[model samples]
Target chain A: MVDVVKFSGEKEKFNPNKILKTLKRAGASREQSRRILKDVESSLKDGITTKEILDRVFSGLRETPGIAAKYDLKRALMALGPGGYTFEKYFAEVLKHYGYEVKINQLIKGKRIMQEVDVVAKKDSTYMVECKYYNYPGNYASTKEAMYTYARFLDTNSRMHNFDFPWLATNTKCSWSAIEYSKGVGLKITSWKYPAKESLQRLVEAKKLYPVTVLKTASKFVKQRLLDSGIIMINTLMEMDISELRRKANLSESELKKAILEARQISV
Target chain B: MVDVVKFSGEKEKFNPNKILKTLKRAGASREQSRRILKDVESSLKDGITTKEILDRVFSGLRETPGIAAKYDLKRALMALGPGGYTFEKYFAEVLKHYGYEVKINQLIKGKRIMQEVDVVAKKDSTYMVECKYYNYPGNYASTKEAMYTYARFLDTNSRMHNFDFPWLATNTKCSWSAIEYSKGVGLKITSWKYPAKESLQRLVEAKKLYPVTVLKTASKFVKQRLLDSGIIMINTLMEMDISELRRKANLSESELKKAILEARQISV
Candidate 1:
């Protein structure tokens, strides 16, 4: 059993490096620390946000007894400012992974702006997009303004350079009024839901776009099978006529019972 | 000169616990880290959030630069999640320093049901506020929905509780239609602006709230004279009357000239 009193750091002892270093000094191998740090750095390079890093660190620490003190970790993390930028950046990277050309720290018109626009795929001359990770339950007045500004900017800049369509994406369902407003103002709005289990299975069908390695192995089969069964169930329910099956089986009521017994006997 | 290259501790070689132990080793005295840790524990006698601990660590680190980069501080910090109770808790504390009571992880209703209100502050019985920190141009619609939800929440909650006023707050300024829409829905919207230098000077006048402290020593007459002059300047500005000085001096143009000449002669 871990010594709670000996292992517990102070309330503010959640410093990641400090905790890692302390563990190393207490007989944990330097190589192990290096391994964790490499994972962290790779996560960062893969565009994991600072907040996610904190989460991952805490998660890893929780796995080892006496490795993480409840209070100390929080204290160490509180030292950093609320890491909004890190979260936003990582969310953008996730979108970009799906064949989207991501633009960070972009400006529309003369106003400077930073928003995670998911996919900026060129559909013919127009940029078709699916926006994800949008803050849910907010008014689109500013989004409209951003669209108007972007549209105006695109019209001038793109025409001069001869570029085409610009698309807008959103995570939460768009507002009817906002959609109408965008239409009235000649701005295009597109929707893209998160990759749910069902969708993930569908996406995996075209495995070239997203390798199976990207998903967890154990749970992956479960979701895929569920999706497969759902489709089969729906198709049979909708298109397969029971009367046709009966006709194909060529069985009357008494004959059906005899046939079922024979079929069971054959299997036995 | 600051050695930027010397600061590079390859992430592949990072050990978080080593960093903690190093701070214990390099702090002002052998007991300094212990004392700070004790202070953190005492401060967190009540339940303390992860962010509060981080803030303390950063504060302690800021005061001691020798051990700053020794920890590979940045990488360790990335372990936290992006936005959740942790980030909201930190954001609330910062806002609280400026006199706000904020809530985190709550749903709001406006045109529709919206979840995830970052920060909500109450100024008075009548004022309800929502705070948002977005690095990029946010989807205004969602924010508007958040603000609307906040408004609606307050509208219902305030009426039920019989609160007098309600208002919404945001870091990003609301668009014209959002503001108008809010008005239509009877929601008062407000934006918080950080105090300017001039505002701080004005704050000095509220000396009862912020008392001046003496650092070393100054002559009594000099102190009295400085205070009197400051008061005079304030009064004069308040009344917007420089002419009052002429009356107080009781000097005509000729008399003032004669006095200046007499002073000059005495000096000579």
Candidate 2:
């Protein structure tokens, strides 16, 4: 097997044999090796991890023109491993393409929320999306429960506390029971897979219109302080008067002031 | 609300209203309070703790005639919260009804394996069972990976590691598909949800044929242990040397001898 320079920014050309060798060495049988190699070679680029290679293959399938095979997303999700489902990953990419600011794994009160959200867009409102890749009939039950939980979560949270528009998105079919249950309870349900082609086109178009951006910038010292303190949300910092933020985050007053100043600079 | 002396050898009788009042005061809603009262009144005996009352209520519903209409098990399970899925509670009842000695939270080498199933039952050879309940569908994938990883576990620590079928128990469910996936895997999958009812009844009835003579001569302590261990399978115990059994259980030599002798004394 050729020794590959993995993470350099160069656009390395795809090599089928190199990919096959890697898969085979990872304990693939001949058939699996060839299949994975063919899938990876079509989208392989420099600096991509094995995870990226796999994701790119699946994402390519999603992008294929006129190839919308309404396959069970839950089955696809199962292949992603346990607890590997993240609506945030796809939504973040979509939001990035649409020019919205994104923050991930933002910590508050010493607890790391799984993710901050899809976007903290214009108008000071955060659009948080709860994604469900429901496969089995029973999967909808928990997905509905999560929607209720996350909605309640944001209602009282300091950061997105009065944020408008909590979006609950699902990639596969929601059970009729769950749909009716949610509707009866006045919970919003967004289906990326429903209402046929036009509905999907609108979502895809929305992503294009809203490309996400990382707007957060701070001084080197302040950035390092925030990182060390584990407070990643800007609003969380905003909620704290600089002194309190410093005391609770274990940051000195000078460090807190520097971070606040840097954030203000970026906003200006 | 009539007081009836429960099975605890106490003078106090059980009161349904009292149990309802306790649950209500603990923040249970009126509906929850009513259900708890009905469960306690119908199934519980005198002097039972609140915890025991709840456990018995749920356990009784496990086989109550058409109890699904009366109480939805899934909703009940969800209400128990995450840790409620542990082997210490529900799964133990499932194992007990199937005539297996249940042990929970057994620490081995300073690591708790959650539950180590010693034996499911001796149908020619004793079978071990492992129970896992996922809080989310995403959890299913990693669990499948771990189940696959148990291939190494089976090869190393199998009781029949040296000679096959000296014992035959599964390391994990044989396939990712369903509880019945072990049909042709040379190992049977004895999951909580998929036991054959007739076979279970047969086993239970057969065990009942040998009434353990309530022998007063035996040490009460030893007798209790023997009963707890389900000494009906005395022939299988004879097949196992006492020291080897004790070593597998990590018991002291004296304890091993005492347990085996006590088991021997109680049968026939």
Candidate 3:
């Protein structure tokens, strides 16, 4: 047993089970999860911050090719932020893969107000979604955001002849008040791991809509350039020829081939 | 101008114009409003509490038959609580007057949860309402209540094939966060003098569904008995024959007659 210090300055006995479980949730096999936990446990010392342990695990996973793809996913998702627009586009692609016709940044006129809907999806029913992207992991979508989205729905729905479903989708978990408010207003919500069966992770895994930020071989500058040119999804890059990718992403031939190979290898 | 102390213990110069505006909003004529203000101004003393001013206004209005009906309205609405169930029934009656088919204390099953709705009204559209009744005038319906109500709406609507409007109607004002949150969730809200044209006072005055507690002639005990018997609205009481009113409300013959006559006079 090792004493670990949390971000809040509290000390508690560290449990290796927590790390093992997290590794498994990220798609590691049982053997790989146990191996990762053993490595983390061997490096643990008294007063080590939880952040340091996570950094160690992340760096250690890079040496293991088989499990690195799964482990890099959470880190890649976190890196997509501080800029919410990229996440929204990425989210739109995920929804599109689920068979919904999606339009981003749409303006609709409601009875009493004009609303800017982040994404409008249509299948049998029209859905107006407010995409909340947080730069940091711990930040939550608040009740205030949920309330405002609902009001916009009311305004827009009053003017429409057809019924519209209001949804609040965030990159991170919503606050307790936000979740409660969303449920009360008939607003569907999808957060990172909330709603269990239909969370962002579930959708990502089901649709295989992995973002380019997850490719460990790509440099931050190359990733940013590709993201800027709207090449967000790994599938999108994989579909493109290496020459086209080099031209669009402003990458060297060698870097482009490596990125494309990494995207192809991990996505499968 | 007289200086008055607020409930929060802040002293400010009292303006008679503020009183006049409040009277007018409650449906008092200009002449009657000015007369009431003059009486309040003359009686005012330095460092008087805001509650004391309201008390003086209420007492002074009781003497004037022409203006009393309008001024007692705010007070009567405030008296509806300590018991929220009674208020829900009273609110149902008000909805009924607006041509809605109303049900009180209904159980509805949502996709994820079952909800006990305070009142449900159906007309062209269905409305699920949560009634918040506060016993005292100074108390406000809070953000926590709004959040919970929204969650219930979400759960219930998930199972429903038809569209339903979720509304929160309170006899008192809602807190700032509550109001903000209600808007976000698309939850319709009706509170005392809130949202200007769609407030509870506006709805009551439009339909003339004044509750029995609004009658200055009825004592607290008698009012409670009438409410307990489900004789909530003035219109409902006015429709009842004197003998039935006495039997159902357990009021003395004279008290019944006086109450019935007051209901009849004020309703017109």
Candidate 4:
């Protein structure tokens, strides 16, 4: 076991199973994963940061093209915006994919006022999820934001928007205080890395619902332009032929060829 | 009587007594108020805006030197500060003068988080006021703001901050929707002209607690500078000798003399 420093400053002996599990989740073959793990372990220095180790593993996944994209889901989710339906629409699609009837940016009329709810979904129970998307790296959602969002839900939840549950969905982690208060008040939250097996990251990975921005074949600038034009999901981009994709999104022939190749790989 | 259009676009026969009453309230003697009202009415045309009448009346008060300053109280309160104590300090002093022990910018700890309450006051009951000061003309507080404030109060009011009453104090009006929701949620509000008898303007005038910026004698630039330096109260400036006043505020000899003379006029 190699001694490693985690992101939170915890010193731990690195477990091969952890990286191996992630590699398997990213759809890399068992032999390919073991070989990459061996190469990483060979180069690892004791007390090296988890960040460094993850970066190495991330670059190592490029050997398999689309597999690396699946592991880069967190960045892709955060990259889901500044466009009209990239974040909220993406979340709504994810909800719909899970068999929940969904509404995006619905204007809700309460007893006294009209407020817009980001994503309202219902399955066994109705839930209104307020999406807080921030692009700043490592910026945790503040306690005030969680409280404010919950307060709006509470203020109007009395007679309108009759959501059985109030949930805050964010692309970033929430502050510890926000988490504690949210739990105390019964306001459920889903963030990039929170709530364990049901975190935003976990949910996306479990479902294999990768955003088009995740594809390594697409340049960041081209991906952003495509995202701007509202072609966010890899499934949507994969379904479009090269001519249709060119008509919808400004992509060069070579870029289109590579993107389609990776999209196909990811689809498999 | 003149047919005048008010700000709200209502056409009504203007009541001279209304202007007379405001003049009297501004500390003008009945005889002076009657003469000024006569001048204002003579100049008013049919379908004239209430704003035109108010402006003429405002300029009319300049002849009385300090009397116009009292009438300019609403603008003065709104003009309170871009400085440290200009708005919050002025409000705290106004509350303190009215027998509420006040704290400005208190870092209040809620059950799970520490939040800043703008002004916390204790009178017959403990109250926390969130002051929404907007310098823009006619910008009303929104329902979202009111709900967010009350939500924070509710979130932490169970154990800490101990505020028995919650208030959203603003320099501008609260939108009708905001007002209704705030009332529905039991969140009190005070704006420039609200609650009829005890609005911010009424409270300031009832105690003759005029800010330094209310002085028409001082140039707007000079008054803003003085407000920036925290010499906001005219009474404080009035009590100081001209040299001391000059030392404390960046007032020239001429400005100091005029400000003191007007301050004395209002003082009486």
- Number of the top DockQ candidate: 4
Q: Write the per-residue lDDT of candidate 2 for residues A69-132, one digit (tens) a residue.
A: 1111223232222232343454444454456566543432201123234333333556455555
What are the DockQ scores of the candidates, in order?
0.01, 0.03, 0.03, 0.40
Q: What does candidate 4's lDDT look like per residue over A74-93, in tens digits? A: 66776776543568888887
**lDDT of each residue in B1-268, candidate 3, tens digit only:** 6689975477899988778877775556787677777878888888888888888777766655434665667678878776788888888888887888988888776554355788888998888888989876567787656765765576567545243778888988887867776776677888887878978888988777788887778789999899888898888887888788888988899887777777766766
Collision count of model 4: 0
Full ranking by DockQ: 4, 2, 3, 1
lDDT of 1 by residue, A32-99 (tens): 56666566555553333445554555555544323332212222212111332322333234344455
Q: Say which docking band candidate 2 falls in.
A: incorrect
Instruction: Sort every candidate by TM-score, greatest first.
Output: 4, 3, 2, 1
The superposed Cα distance between candidate 3 and the true structure at residue A40, in angstroms, equals 1.1
Error of 3 at A57 (Å): 1.3
Candidate 1 off by > 4 Å: A1-118, A124-201, A212-268, B1-108, B114-128, B132-268
lDDT of 3 at B193: 76
| Residues B1-268, model 4: lDDT tens digits | 6698865577899898888877887789887887788888789888898788888887777678778888767667767755434587788888888899998888877876677888888999988888888764546788767877887788658653577878888877778888888777788888777777878888877877889878887888888777877777887787667776677776688878877788889877
- Per model, how many backbone clashes are there? 58, 17, 12, 0
Instruction: Please report the candidate that would top TM-score against the real structure.
Output: 4
**Model 4 docking grade:** acceptable
Stretches > 4 Å off in candidate 3: A1-13, A25-29, A161-163, B1-268
Encode model 3's per-residue lDDT on A53-92: one tens digit a residue.
8887877677554356555565677678666788878888
